[model samples]
Target: MEARLSKETVLKLSTDHKFGAEGNISTHKVEFIVDSDFGIPGAVTVVNGYDNEFFLESITIEQNFHFACKSWVQPKKLDPEKRIFFFNKAYLPCETPNGVKELRERDLMQLRGDGRGRRVCSDRVYDYDVYNDLGDPIMGDAYARPTLGGQHNPYPTRCRTGRPPSTTDSKTESRPSESELIYVPRDEELEDTKQETIDQGKLMAILRNIMPAIIDKIMGNEEVFDIDHYIKESGQSEFNSQLPLSRILLNLGGAVQEFFKFDPPKTYSRRRSHFLLDDEFGRQVLSAFPLSIESLKVFPPVSKLDPSIYGSVESALKEEHIIGHLEGMSIQQALEENKLFILDYHDVYLPFLERINGLEKRKAYATTTIFFLTKMGTLNPIAIQLALPTGNPNTSSKQVLTPPKDDTSKWLWQLGKAHLLHPHMRYTLKTNAISRQTLINAEGTIETDYTPGRYCMQFTSAAYKDWWRFDMEGIPADLVRRGLAVPDATEPHGIRLLIEDYPFAADGLLIWSSIEKLVRTYVNHYYKNSNAVSSDNELQCWYREFINLGHPDHENATWWPKLANPEDLISMLTTVIWTVSAQHAVLNFGQYPYGGYVPIRPPLIRKLIPKEEDPEYSDFVKDPQRYFLSSLPSLFQATKFMAVINIGSAHSPDEEYIGGRNDVTSWVGEPEIIDAFNQFSMEMKSIEMEIKRRNADPKLRNRCGVDVIPYDLLIPSSGRGATGRGVPNSVTA
Candidate 1:
């Protein structure tokens, strides 16, 4: 049978195509078909089957815009409700000002493997309707649910929340047409759904009064519109009070957009200090799970790396201050034992500190915080160093503060951790920050902005590969590189993390290993062995393009892993899927619950540690608690960050997790491959239960503190909304 099709104007394409544009010729006999205008310079069309029954195998646009050369799709049956999208990248919506510099996919065999599942993921877009009448001001803002972008959500999460029998949790909320493309994709077969753009409207009738507040907060401020070094508060009125626990609900319940009111100095009372400066295990425990566990590294031999931003490594940070906490162990002994860790940000933020601190009320620093892993398997901060730029670039001014000896030092140390953790967010997303959000905006710091055009992909890729090492990204390797683990054949990936009970690495390794095993089985089935892997011209060419085109800067880097064998291929593919799924799940998803309390983990430190000579130092000395409040974000900034994270952290009503079914199993003929995927899914279910058990275990205090919220972020299961939990296959949130 000849493949035939019909078409419409070219909508944008979400190329995270699996079996998508591959043009694979297998046992199937139907010839690939396309529209007459398919190759034209500006083609806008969607392909439908002759009877709207054509399940697309692969798609190609040999001659066209440089942004996307080909489009492939999964062979999902189509009807009136389903259609394959060919949306151009230009028309795609972006939450950040800089449009998608690179569409998720432009090549057939993507840099990230799709053999396991979808390589490209997207978050659904929701229509604006704060009051269902606020209209276009908030139009197209991303919905704050853990949703995916597809025609249908096959495995919509069943929210299993406990209640007093009054709360209503949605079971089958539908997926939306719009999605924010989350990850890059690679090659594989797909039974993809045509992303449909539906014109729909819904509103919370009660939130009518709050619409103005939200619109003003998101759309009104120069702070939201413009970003200097200083982080500004979003607008919050007296009307915008706290919703029981949810900020998203607070605004939706009509408690937002009412007016602008600064969280008064008095409001920043002893309460704010209670979490950071006062609590015993405040900074240490949060780092293990929901926040940046990836940032920790085995304590360095040298305390400082950049002399321009630092004077000497040991001058400020000393051994005695931390040795006391290491259980009578010497500094060298503790480090040798892998018991010492540090979150170092001195090199990343030093340059930005000057600009970030230019504003009078704002204070930022390049910092480092050292930790000692306690016998309890929890990390305890021992020392913190705050460094400020001295304009010389050749010389620096810095101070090292340890766990408090006095009330003054206590507050100072807290400020140091805040200084380090705050900017860590900015730099961690260095790729995103420089490409999509912070620097890519037209008026951003980069004058020769490298985005919004043909070179956008190349520019971002080149810029991306330069900032960090790609080979060291996987969780297992990262752990080893940081000296937190040692090679142990018994362990996953032949490496065992030194911290036996570290929550992030522990939960993630379970998920990571399952993915590796499943992908290894599936890839071996296709490639046969190492010789086949190296001999495949298409695979080798794809490899070159991945290194040279996708990450040009690293093109000559010898450290890059090769797809020369099935094992090599398995390792690489597993990293890709694991990064996008479990890794992204852990790094994200818990932002609001852990950081929502501004006092617990503030993203922006509005004020710097005051010098005794400075006037603010007198005020700080008088009431350090109030001084800390003045130094943090204003009410508006806090709310804005909260709202942003809340939107980001929540799961959509229709999110598909790791084990959730896609159409992968039906087409593959090999029972082994099918069995591999089924086994992977089953193991994922097992992982979900495993994580639940761990969360409930009273012994794992890092996750199950009686007073703490369970660290369920890694549960390969999800339900609707931000439940401080759930891990989908991609970083949709």
Candidate 2:
């Protein structure tokens, strides 16, 4: 058999040979000829490496290659040493998180999140149509999708050649092609695990495992997907009401998925997630949910929602109501004390409401939820105001929904919180996904999601534009931006949070500090001082291109500080590393745990709160439970979305969690740098236990509320499948 090894293979001998000496062992030898063009060895001659009695048969070789683990300085071409390691337990074909053994190829055809999926879109790269978005600031005069010339559109086919393939020749018109039944890529092509096959087999697998169980145990053909369904009997606590949440956190939940990826509620009959969404504890716990509430900030916001127009919801969030929750603290006092924090979605959704509401069975409000930090350090929801842009950007109508004084009001408050989080789930994933190649592999999700038409990109772009705060991808910097913390020069990381019990921030700080220390050590090892940082041409050039070319729009933005000091370099490098590993895990891996349940955390909510004048009002009043279900995605739509998030939440067999795996024995780096990373690994090891302790602590209600489940999203390690924990080192989903 004729066999060939192009490059990237090696078989070494234990005995050492002198520099430039031929490989020799008695009568045996091994020789390799280097490829001149690429400077890589291609031909190897293992000439009788064994005894003369043992004949040399054919020499076989295989090499696994992967894209470099993304640091800010990712290699443009393949670099073997920097390659991310992945496992292909193809033997365990059914071993998928959420039990989705195979994927829905037709449904998820263009939605794959890896190099293989990118290859699928290689031909029908056009999106079946053009989006001449007149308001696109990047293009100045928009005439194309990002795939043509937008963000993360690596191939600018239009720019390279003045025209792209006709928009008419895309999507359905181009005609779909069949895909292989199984994901049978070469041994080297293991990275394409998520979406090589082109059918709904994975979706079918997920539905068969988890989706039907919901109907069988709770809903029982009720035709509704509501948290209330979790409760099996009257007055039963939500804690013991259902087991699927565990099945989701366990069976269906991903054990330790690499890349990508909600809570809370009302009513005893409806089932409550006290740890996730209690009116007082769970709602505030969600402030640190890490999905949509990253927008939470000290209220009255540093800037008003709809600041461009006459945007103010201050009237709706009354001082009396807020002060009632703040004990003796006045609104102004809480603001000064950092006791008041707001997750305001008003400014973001208002501009696009008119267009978004027009989409079929879809409607949303620009919402603002206010939470007051209690004496015990848990956040308590004071007021939630839902607003609608009154057809004018300048004016919006707002109505406040407070903690339930009655039953109608209880579900209303629940509805408000649900809507607050629902709209931003995909956006949060997309924004973070776009933050790093590692944040979320949810690359094509925005386009391929269930949202109607161009509105998906429009909504996502609005979120990105609104959320583009000038902060490093660090929780400390984010907290500072959100006014959740003050910059304290004396604090270890140079910042201290106002709310000490904050789960995501508190747990994240340890991870963040460890990472920063590692970066400082790594950068300081090479550059002795500011002079070195400034003088390094390669470093300076990389930074220049990173800004000028990578984010050209913000190249000259005020936040782009001069890279002249080692400390500055440390900050830059740490941001890159954290964004890829821990930060991305916090954002990505927990999708199925929270979103998998679907009741407490719906991806989208369709109807607005009904009034007497509305026709749906009578129906809502008659059967609020069924009305709410009607507002949610139908069973099929909801289950299909479940499958999407489930797929995003699972890990491939060969997973690389945040700590480099045991197999990664060495890297080409300074001894001190390796030591720093090892230190980081040690610190990361302690994090899971620390988090477990906090969850065990009765004082932290947000984490260990009325349920046995605690916030494990920040847990640094996860097993295979959807385990609701672990931070993958790379974007696996």
Candidate 3:
């Protein structure tokens, strides 16, 4: 005589009514009795789940007739008019008995009559009507049907069970008012959106050719480079007629190099440069770059451990045990002490630890260009080498200059180290606006002038926690001699994409001093303020308002609320900035304008028509900006899909898990969370389908000699999915 609610029933009810503290509807177990004459259920009492409020109002006879119920208790309290509506929709386990007699006879079930009340009562009465009869009795499965004017449901709805198929004509079907259909996107509107996207793609292709050429021309010169020169140069060239000024500077800087190129001293050899090109120097440069220890070859490597080992949260919690030394300290307090410890940790302890751990020696590159004022003149040496750093500068390597092997040279070197190590030295250097690039050569003599030579180096920003630190106010001579010191020319952490610093290099490139400013100005507005219909709409607004900033209406606009909170906003923007800058660093750090591609790959070249026949094909270029914007939806969509998978797997006990801590399903086990995740998946899938439909036109495919449909470029190609090279079976097919 007992029945359980199906999972489908719970999910639908939860979604439709809303749950938790914010929900509009509440559940109640109501007592009712079946009328012998009408074979209909009449409500006796209804109790609300939230406040235990009882409602005993009489229900209409017509509603009872519509419900076609025998004596039973309603699962939850509802309006007297909607009692039948709720009863018709709820699903019950099929094992329950029938009729009012069975409902009253349930006392046949044993009970601990005198025992303390159980925390949870499974015996609460509920009668789920599986059949709804309007004319004649008919059976229904799940979900109660409402009249045509009833509230719309998100679930897949069906017609009333006993009702015959509507004989309504096309005119009747078309009679619904515009407000009833307002949420649906019209076919014409969808088509226009599709066309707009294609137009953006077309415009991007044209700019691709124009933008990169502008960067190359500017970086190749020794003189001050200007975008105006290129604008004039482009006017004479018929192909560059419509190139936009704002578009060309999308890389943040109008040019890739920091300033007009300062050619490495001609005597420097390309092949034998032990400077920044050497293994040691490369390591030092990477050290200054913003990255976590996990990214930079962490200890107790993940590859060596079994996946099962990471399946539990214990392992993740254990990793944080290293911070146990500051058990009761506040985050700000820990940070202050951590900063001091980090300076020594990176310079001395890190090297010592690596040595003891049998790790290879890492090269140290000069952060600032070293200048030596000799009797000959001022010479800017790209790098310097250490000689007997612990005792005195006079004792060692032939590569480093040791004048007269006397106290004068040693004393002068020490004085220079002390001057360079002064905490505020970088502030003065910024005012001078000097810039230099990493040089890869071992040929030049390591040289520096003691008579106030310019050695400007910016420290890494504070956002790196304590990872990229320096002994700013300490004796550099001893540290350098020990091969544990970095040059003053080094840029701060997170400045990998120096393009942002180009416009304000003389202002000391302090734009990244606080991520909050950027988040408040750029990230927040796009996420929150704009009324975008989709991710495309949001991204377009972002580019127009923040990145371009050339649009007049957005000049004074403040705030965007794309994400839920400040934490999420910070996390998202941090990822975007770090991703963009890291790639830019790879290109501009050593060889300027090499690799010429944006970090994230753009959407595949769209072939809208035959290459030779299409008029726009001649000007068709690859616009990375458009492609980058387009690709963002895929990331968000994929994240949703992955969450859905995790949620689905969480419900299955048979599913094999990789690691204790690594299993996302373990972390996201709530039923509500799973339902929310599925809803997002449905939305994203709908958007993906729309995109597919737009791209499905035959003309979009390359239809030359051998027609080939383009593979989905937005999806990542994994080695695990490759056929020949450790690719998975899914990708190979």
Q: Number of the top candidate by lDDT?
A: 2
lDDT of 1 by residue, 446-548 (tens): 2121111111222223234334566776778877776667879986568887666567777877887898888878686677667877876656876775565
| lDDT of each residue in 222-304, candidate 2, tens digit only | 36655433223422222332666765455333322211111121212133434234444344345336535433434544335
TM-score of 2: 0.67
- Write the number of the candidate with greater TM-score, choosing between 1 and 3: 1
lDDT for model 3 comes to 0.23
**Global lDDT scores for all candidate models:** 0.50, 0.52, 0.23
User: Of the candidates shown, which would achieve the greatest TM-score relative to the real structure?
Assistant: 2
**Per-model TM-score on C-alpha atoms:** 0.63, 0.67, 0.18
CA error at residue 429 for candidate 1, angstroms:
16
Select the stronger candidate by TM-score from 1 and 2.
2
Choose 1 or 3, whichever is better by lDDT.
1
- Higher-TM-score candidate of 2 and 3: 2
Identify the superior model by lDDT, candidate 2 or candidate 3: 2
The 10 consecutive residues of candidate 3 with the worst lDDT sum are 437-446
- Candidate 2 Cα errors over 4 Å, as ranges: 1-29, 32-164, 167-288, 291-315, 392-395, 423-453, 469-471, 662-670
Candidate 3 residue lDDT tens string, 620-690: 32432232222221222222222221121111111111111112232132344334434433543343343
How well does candidate 3 match the true structure in TM-score terms? 0.18
